[model samples]
Target: MSKKGKKPADSPATERPRPIASTVAPPPARSAPVTSASSPPTAPPKPTQAAPPDALIWFDKRVKITLGVFVGIFLLFVLFKWHYISLPAWNEILPDGGPAKRGLVAGTPKRIRMDDYAVGAPWILSNANTGFKTENEAVGGLKTPLLTLPVKHPIIIFKIGYWGFMFLDVERGYSWMYNSSPLILLLGTFLFFLLVSKNQYWLSLTGALTLFLSSGTVRWSFIPSSMIGYCGLAFVGAVYLLRSTNPKVYIPVAFGLIWIIVSFAITLYPPYQIPMAYLFIFLLIGYVLNERKLVFPPKSVLVKLISLAGALLVAGFVAYLFKSDVDETVKAVSGTVYPGKRSETGGTGFIANWYSEYYSWFFDDQQFPKGWLNICELSHYLNFVPVVSPLAIALFAFTRRIDWMLVGAMAFVVLMWLWMEVGYPEAIAKATLMSMVPTRRGQIPMGVGGIVLLFLYLAALRNVSLSDLKQAIPVWFTPVAIVGIVAFVVYTAYVNINDAEGMLRTDQTFMPVLFFILMNGLLLFSLNIRYRMALFCGGIILFLLPNLKANPLSKGLTPLTENLVYQNVKTLVDKDPDARWIVNGSQFVTYMVTATGAKQITGVKYIPNRKQIFSVLDPTMKRDSAYNRYAHVTFQTYINGAQGDTTILAQQYEDGYVIAGDPCSPKFKKLNVKYMLYDHAPQIPYEVRCMKKAVELGSMTIYERID
Candidate 1:
């Protein structure tokens, strides 16, 4: 293939699993003597690949370790989610009964439309002709969807015991599917470990478990982050397929690439399609440069062009099915206030004006590219997913020779850095112009970078060249690696000190830091487990025990949360036929609908009508205008001009009542929200003010619509 100017990858031999029989020849024999005009070249016999007795032992041990790790992980999750020990069914924040009222499990347009309030109802519940419906620009003509199947249901279903759940699988919780990606990402880690490591099974499982349950993976699992997950899924396939020295590997890799592209249509980040395309180009270019194999193989650029074009065609066809209004989609997505202020200034009044213009994009020395931007402005940008500072991590490749995972990792680094490059202050104008979040939304690259570092470190540790370590006699590098691991852990811990507050604030931040600490700690300790299992286990697990309890699913929760759960009970019922009323003291919406035979909106989304709401529960603020009450709500934005209609929308007795926070912040005064419908506010500001307790239904408090 090389003699023909063909890429090594394009060679028919590059994609399949290499034969490993002892009698089989080594896949590459590039050292064969070249035939010249002056001399006859003797054909050297093929190099054998017979497995040594020790190789079988190594393989078996690796598999054993992998199984043990997998089982341990599964058990940990199962134990935490053993049974929902949550508090009694009380009112949930932004109480609403959406899709359940519409006879569905939530995530439907009926639910999302009301909850998100950012899009038109029709566009959200597209049930019309063709595939999915979408628009390229805010007001562009309707276009086809990008995915092959209607992306309406891009989740998976798992029947774990009696609890059947849908994830990324639209059939279940629509917007709640972040767990699926971790599983796929684990496969990539496993295959990578398979590529390195003397105790292959132990190495593969260790990396796989880390990737699978990585803090970032779990924290991001709740939202609609399937794009990252799907990409990860594809990355696994691509790495394995490309690394093989046989043809079978290429076929799947090609298909995997197509699948990766196809999945992008369903994401909020539509423009990312361009970068993803570039990623494919990146892979092809790498293969061509390294192995001198044309990335698309069949000896011609035409085939590659056709294949790529076909993928684009499929995407276009998918795009056509959308009938949604472009304005709605773009507004729903691009309307964030970066630095805490609107990117565009216009319209509205007073609080609305203030809200639309309040600024928070302050430049922090820590965030700046060397802390250059010190501007204070209100703009729409995104908070980055917490990951290690990518710059410090990129030093790996310069420090060592590269392999398959290493290459994929390098690509990941580029993409993640590209994400930061695309956003940050340096590229604000360009990113805002595109209506995309700062490059942080593309955190898959960060994840890939992590995987790369893990692999590089492990590869260095587990290399067979260190015969002393492989044979268990220990090597010179072992002590150095140990010291290196210790320093890395301590330095990372120091980096975390600055971030500890953020980590403490949310499970999202805490998990990543804790995992980094533990992973390094484990890697360090695992190498010398004989004398310190108790010490290492105690140190790491003790810190983890407190944090693990924070997961709502974990056992032995605090009684305060338990008692609160027992205090609130809300329900739906057709009781007292004349009223056919829906009443609740519980948190569950489904119970409300099932108990009361009335229509109720399920879930929460911003609505412009908040200013007109009249509260019936609170006596102290009954006369306050909805507009007056609304402005006091700290977390919300004014939907209409502060000058717009301040008149109360619903009379105290007519329309259904809404359940919300108390009169603590000026928000209640701004909106003139007439209701004080609770005994307590457990969340933030609302909790500050006391209210009359309704009824303790199973642990949740039920408030009343006061007069």
Candidate 2:
């Protein structure tokens, strides 16, 4: 402190600045302090921050470790799916029960040949086995990785059809491939949420698991028809397009438009008339601001009108093309009875009567009718399993776009119903039954509504909110959930029908009622993530345990002969591409030949046997089952549909390349047939004989077609 007795703190070099002169009196300055050499160096200026608690690296390391744990979980998810869930589901949906269930397991590959075979009428009839028959030929038959953007239209259609067709694997045939569109939409939407959400991992996982466990989704896997899938996909496309970034863009819009047009064509089939789904895209699009006008100067209002008109005109032209094509097809089929009419006489007569009863099913009734003939309707065929419509319908309010769309759908359905009942049909109820479009399937659309609501509910939650008190739920959603619960419970009970313990239960006589009950329960209202996981696991269990348990109703049956008609056709085709064989069975052969590589013969009916005649003939025709009478009628039918001269069965086979008669059947002996051709029958010797350990190649016995 030193110079002139001033302290070091008062020195000019060390002193702080004085306050402003006008505002306050100036402080005096002092001289610097003198030190010997230098005072022990003052400690360096103190750091500004307090020492961090322990090591900051710990927090960072924890974050990294947590991240690593999540990665591990994701890997685990993939592993579970690959090892225990998806792979098995794929296996199940692929062959014996799913994919490779045919008799040609050891067959040699023939070159893939493509063609639009001109099949005029149903031939090679064999409608007996409806179980898990659709083989997803496009996926299974065509050697391709993806279906989109194929060069050929038929191939494209086949590819698109395959995805939808193979998605569901049932006991017999596949549901419409169109349903895949909706499933695809659901998956896309789910993936979008998974990608954007804060808790993406769980959401992503849930999305993946969704396809594996969804019973409603899986139940439709193997339906032979593709119509339902298409209609549902139309809805899916509309929903997806409207929600997309560029609603006016051509890609999705084009797909949507084209699909709608395609949908209309397929809807001609009586079973596919789900008319309630009127395309309400215009209504939805009306809400979107046309970004096109923002960039370009606005055109006159009349230009908009003209554009709409032009678009309509183009659409009309396309419609005309489709109409022309269908007209040509219908011209060929003009004399034939529709599928429903055929069902009545061939085997499904009750189904025909039911559809013919009142044009449409009365779903609002306290109890919807369950008729054995209506094989396609869940109410009848799956009587023991039950039909759960309420569970899906109650979610109408909670679904985002669904409630409004459902309203439109309901209106459309009602309009269709009215048309059937009072407008379209003139002969009281009879005309309605015969001519009106099908529109009573409230289950699928309603089920979709429920699923959308569930998704919304799931998406709206935070991990904390869901974990904590229920206070965070939107006030409006609580009632929705309550309604859903009520609906779900109601439908569950409605569909929860009891099996009549009789010869019915005799086949699998010993299985507990609980097992069946649990299986049914799993199918109904079980779409949660965990439940889906369980389903995947359970499905795996079923595949692994191929128990040869028998149902007593089977009565210890055995096979008498093996009808290799399909195999026989394949052989004939292979022997000579031009060789034609006449099939006199049911509707089963058409699908089998189509799946395998055989062309349809004209001898069969699309809806075969007795059904065809009943459908076309006046109702006054008396029922007769005598073989000679049937033989005469069949012979005439063959002449009319194809060859002017009918080929006599016994005489044509003299060339030795033909087979005739049921080898072990009394009918064969009665017909006085010299040679035998094998066919499938769940009778005493046939079942046992057909099951002989056999290896099949491309040359595997398909069917023994009698010449």
Candidate 3:
């Protein structure tokens, strides 16, 4: 045979070539390399298998499902068996050793949130039994039934999750009260995962927990917290409808969009809602621009547009159904003297904005310094965005690339900070409709934006390599970022130190310092891809530290409802369902009376009743500014007025009023005041003779009108 045609001695000449495994394959196994006789033939090296994926990556793939299950179980347990409601705080007003004293299963209830314990909760429970209506007969007079559906007021019928439970049964709906905070947290986390993190489960959970557990959400865990979740849901729904090609997703997304819009509109808290709307608008624009290809494919454009338009039309129709009720409420609220026509140009509460998050941990049980704001007012999100902004700027500047989401988030936050720290012009404020957003209320958007910015920056960091970072960013950037962060922290500390009046103790500074260092450290680690998991885990830990004990884990509503005084009031109202009541003591008594289904003239007023209620007390309009606004009316007898006269003493507080009057007055009679709750006996004999005591427990006394 010719040498060129000859086969190797050990080869099977008839063996056919193996089929290629892929379009590209390793060069057909090379013939064994020629070996010298001196070197024994070595076994051909084994093909290398790919190293197993890192364990953490495996965990990451399933972590979302695992964490989701955990959250679901925790939610169900708390909703049915235990809750974190602050109803136990009502114990402070109950007589010592009274039959209905609220008991705690875990943490202490926060008295600082009387609005929740003494007012909002009672109103919700009362409304549950009385039927959810725009007008709550339990409060104000029947003709002037208090507007119970506005602001943070929780009318179960309008509340999303709670309303569903009411369909099952009223008790189930009532029990669902505890579900609000946890449900908000879950919704925020779930929606943020889809909207901001691109389904990055761990990052979304961390951000949501941090944001919702912050002082603002924990203390004002009603409208503000709900707004965050609803906004997130709306954004996610909009994005899904915009990008989805499947017909199955369209219906659910559309329904969710409608639900979120209606719920958000009904919330009626413009302070938080307006700023949040501005932030989301910025986010939506940036998101669309960034994901233009996915969100705006020409082939799917018609379907997407139709789906969105249909959803919005339905939502508009639903809103139109409530137009009459909403208009009446708007008119009543606008006519009030306090929050009515209240406009702001920002540049207020700067110190609180900067340092309140750090200092608020200490003030949860006590009043914040200056006594101008309570714990809830002082609460703010522990946002690391300010510290991380420099790093983000440097990254984008060096790489010559921009992340629109980060830019959008940073823009919103920066604008809010400017509005808060340096007053904005009145013209700009009015034009943007941000005048409705007081600087103090601006924290909601700023805090929410900070969290979004943090996660977006983290998502962006994943696309960057170490080589690109090293080549683009100078080594000195780390120290500069550290120094800037430290300076900001120190400035906040200094501001509080100067103004705290000994309230910010040295020991209290430890947590802020530790958290500052840890948070910045995690942001610094974001520069290196290898430490990404560490950064996420560490960030979650730091965020969780301050909020671990924010609320108590208690069971049931007995703490506020089962007491002897409440039962007695319930009995009295059961006999005379049409009777009206007036409380002559603490505002707590007023709300408690309202909780028993008794018509309370002095309960928290949702809107001023100028013509029927307030005008009767101040007919001459002498104190129109005082009685012409929302207030919790309290009565105190004074000898100055005629035997049956009343005078509005002061309306200095937005939510309260001091009225020096005789409960036996014709004004009270005209209002149909049939019962009086007192913390003390009347000192005036004439006032004493007007009513006879009917129920007494400890210091609280209930009297029936005798006139």
Candidate 4:
């Protein structure tokens, strides 16, 4: 039936619609059958074949599964068994014959990392024997907990190393956790860049390796490295959960976030943690804003926000479970004279140090300038982002396109620089929460931000072609930018050279030229999309080469674990687990004793026990200046025995102190000293009433208190 104002097909009133006329007249119809007999008929064009499917497409499920299987096998069978730990530094202290007999598989162990070898690694092993309790009796007794843990603490109850304990026995668990710290950093950094760059493979990889091999990371591989890694994981998991739409992924991502957050917090190194926290907050805000539509869609925004809040709440709850322990720790640490109550007004850092990475390769602990800086503190990442940032800003201005991530990273870096190189008012520092971060520690986040800015700058230029750049940027800008970058590089080098004051070697003088060339090349390559990945690859090589030796590739912990001295000490401690001992002559021996699970009064003290421990040594509190702070305790024989003093204490440095006293003194007995390990024979005659030689092994002797 016909509808209103419409006609049916059979309606007589329906007229045939005429085609719309063309504006130009059509050509006259060709005459029919005009082809000559000799002319061959044109063959119908062959049907076009579909273009071959892209061979370099992203990995499919099958390929991904195969690769995952291989990675798992490699991790379980190979990586976990070997370690890059600097435990071989013991070879120097205990000299195992010669180079051939040394326990190291390859690379020279850094003696400069005595903290890792002498304190951190030993305490980790000691915890295994103590049922993984937070209070390690080996060092500062129940008052000072082991700040560095490879296993779950009884009170803390959570550590990233719990996975190692779940899979391996105590010894192997220590090895696994030690080896995996760097892996965590590498993987987390890789994942962070991958997510931020939208899965730009080479760029992500370069960023990850650059940070992994960075001097600060390798130098402080235990706590700071793990902290950075966990922070990265937390950021990555947060981003994933925020952008996720699947309910199935929500629970897993939330759980991962909790783990990451807790692990990061427990690292407990505020100097690194505070700065990194500031950097991540900026990045997270910028990321959410940049991906607002995807991260906070109208349909799922509430659910995502609730999931994030829930994850954070659960993490906070877990931390609250150990509130008493956390509070006690925080109180003790905050009360310390060295780090506790320490506030910085900034403007203490040297601008030359930013460029010091170039000369840092030649840093010899022995040859390092006196009272200038230590090796660990001198370490920094080689970052040219600050030098190249002006050009990036100009490009962004000319193109009228701003990458919020780049802006966020740049802003963080600028803030850190201002705090480190420019003094701020105390009120401003407190308001900005920069008081907790020292000028040296600010380098951690600043270096990290610089690298992030560098990669983000490259990512921002990904879609901008060279032709587009030529059109968008002025003719004079290129030469001006080039001159500016060179000037910056030269000025930076000049400052560093003058600050170094002839410390740089003859060959190291070319580092600035190389840096300048690389910076110019990076700028040039970034302008063209084709060379972007190439530039990243070059960067990876540049980062990996010099920093490869930052850490040594050592095999097992046999140097300490299997040595006769450790065996003897372990056997002795096993017999009298409650007896408190002392190590005389060397601090390294004290660390060895701590590792043997023996209670030692003279070892690394995480938290000073002023009331019980220090009071016994200094009853009158006259030596509070020496023993009040956290210190690595070392003992030297009292040369002036005629004075009849039981003990004489002096602060050797901020983190160390020396006590010169007779081992048989009444003060040592009051501290519950049962035995003493001496690196040399006692210069004073052993008092039969108080002490006697227990045994002699090689050049070392152990004295047993016989009160």
Q: What would the TM-scores of all predictions be?
A: 0.46, 0.40, 0.83, 0.84
TM-score ranking from best candidate downward = 4, 3, 1, 2
Cα error of candidate 3 at position 54, Å:
28
For model 2, residues 1-707, the per-residue Cα lDDT tens digits are 01222222212222232211101112344445555666775545422221121111112233335445544653443332211101111121212222321222222211110010111101101211111222111111111112111122232242443432233221111112223333343343333333222123343334333322332233233121234334434443443333333324324444554555454444344432333233233212321222223223432334334444555566566556545534533433333322222211011122222111111122211223354222223321111111223322433222222323223333443443344234443353243232333322333332333333232223322221222323333556545544544443444333323221121222232232333344334432223234442453354234222211100001000100022334444444455443323233322333334332332222222321222222222133332222111111111111222533222332122111111223333332233222211223323444223223222323222333232
Ranking according to lDDT, highest score first? 4, 3, 1, 2
What is the TM-score (0 to 1) of candidate 1? 0.46
Q: Which residue runs does candidate 2 get wrong by more than 4 Å?
A: 1-159, 162-217, 222-256, 259-322, 331-335, 340-376, 379-442, 453-571, 574-576, 583-604, 607-707
Encode model 4's per-residue lDDT on 1-707: one tens digit a residue. 11233222212122222111101122234444555789987655433222111111123343345336534743763344555667788877876354533457667788877777778777876776666666775655344554556435443445655566556775466666676676677667766775666445566667777777777677665446666667778887777566555666656777778777777777766778888887888888887777665555434566766776787777777666566555766677777777678677999985347877756655655556543467677766777775557766776676676666667888888888888889689998887777878887778778877877777766555435566557677667666666766666666667666777677644566765565556555664224445555765685567457766666766656778777778888888888888888888788788888888777778888766666567788778898777666788888877455678568889999988888787678777787788888888767574424777777778888878888
By TM-score, how accurate is candidate 4?
Answer: 0.84
- Tens digits of lDDT, candidate 1, 552-597: 3312211111223211321211222111111223223322221121
| Candidate 2 similarity to native, TM-score | 0.40
Each prediction's whole-model lDDT (CA): 0.32, 0.29, 0.65, 0.67
Instruction: Kindly report which residue stretches of model 1 are placed more than 4 angstroms away from their true locations once superposed.
Output: 1-179, 188-201, 220-228, 236-256, 269-290, 293-315, 323-327, 335-448, 460-603, 606-707
Compute the lDDT for candidate 4.
Answer: 0.67
- Model 3 C-alpha lDDT per residue in residues 1-707, reported as the tens digit of each score: 01222222212122222211101122345566788999997998654222121111122324446556646865675456465666777776675564333556777777766766777767776765466555664544332332442222333234664553445444345445446645665665555653454344555566666665666676665447778878877887776666555666656677777777777767767888888877888888887777665555534666656776887777666566566445666776777776787678998855365656665656655656765466667676766776768777876787676667778889998899888888789998888888888877888777877877877776566445556457667778777777777787777677676667787876678777767665666676335545564566565656556665766766667776677778888888889877888788777777887788677777787665655566677767787777666678777766555543546558748767777777787777887788888888777667867788888877778888888
**Winning model by lDDT:** 4
